[model samples]
Target: MFRVEEPINKAADRMLKTVQLGIFNSIIVNRLWTPLQQIKFFIPTGHGTLLGTWRRLAVCWFAVCGFIHGIIEGWFSLYYDIIPGDQSFLSQLWKEYSKGDSRYVIADNFTVCMETVTAWLWGPFSFWAVFAFLTNKPYRFVLQLIISLGQLYGAVLYFFTEHRDGYAHSEFGHPVYFWFYFVFMNVLWIVIPLVLILMLGDSY
Candidate 1:
């Protein structure tokens, strides 16, 4: 005789399917970006018609922003270099690591700072998209919710991961603007893309 399935096993399976369905739905809808307002919260009020015309442009703008960020921060290492110090941030970073006298949690992994900041900024973009979806189609909120959570996860991982905690603080002697500029640059870099998305009529 065939054995019956365990209740716990069935429940777990159902939960997995629910989560998988939610993620799948988010990806499908986000890629198509069809229901503009519902899937993209940055869509300002009274601009549904323009979404189609500007959607691709908006996406391209954000893509460019992302690429620029990667090039400057990831490739050229601008943020980690060219500061007011004689040595590049990475050089100091390695020096600190070698000397066993690190100060900040994010010191060792300079790249972590870049990743964390970018992810944090991108969270809003995804959030608005999900918010748009929820407002128009409450039933499909689960999908958007999953996507938002994933974005959030990315941001959190960038900041709190142990590997990223290497250079949490700076050891340099500098003005407040030094730190402020560093942060502002990263924030603005990400904001531009988000703004472009909003200008195109995405809501949230």
Candidate 2:
């Protein structure tokens, strides 16, 4: 009877030890799983894919305007004081479309510096957007969002600086063109940033 009781006692001890080890493993797994899920932050998700759909129109818009701002306007700002300087494509442009009592205000020292900075900034982003679009790189979603915010900042500076002087006004200037160039142009920067924030936020 003593020998039989000894084996039964050993068997009970082994069973209890196995159950404790299982509990320990379950606790460890739960703790590790949460942080692993959070690491998903680095990867693009549903909303990022959604924003990708707008790549054609959105990136194109940035690319085209960015070329004009970074190159065309940049060249003019560097040379002319927003006045009709002798003759050039850009100067001709200013003469045709620009309207103001002090049109030179657009290329004032302050405005020229801002445009130059924006030109340098937008040039790289436009290149990146085009490259990313062609490659279908998901990481570009985050880049797009970042650049969009920067664009918004630059737009605000441009708008307020222009506003301090005045908007383009002439006897028969089209409200349509004024709104298109000054209002809608800057407004898109603000709007697109918000859209990118919403759509690319999942990647955060």
Q: How well does each candidate superpose onto the true structure, as a TM-score?
A: 0.29, 0.59
Task: Report how far residue 177 has shifted in candidate 1, in Å.
Answer: 4.6
Q: Ten-residue segment with the worst summed lDDT in candidate 1? A: 97-106
What is the alpha-carbon RMSD of candidate 1 to the true structure? 19.1
Q: What is the per-residue lDDT of model 2 for residues 1-204, given as tens digits with 9 covering 90 to 100? A: 122455877767644644554465356445544443443344343455433335455555555545656666666566656356557655654453453223433446765666676667766676686566545576777668767777778778766766665543422243433553346535877787777678665643
The whole-model C-alpha lDDT of candidate 1 against the native structure comes to 0.39
How accurate locally is residue 177 in candidate 1, as Cα lDDT from 0 to 100? 19
The local distance difference test score of model 2 is: 0.56
Candidate models: Cα lDDT each: 0.39, 0.56
Score residue 157 of candidate 1 by CA lDDT.
48
Per model, state how many residue pairs clash. 27, 0
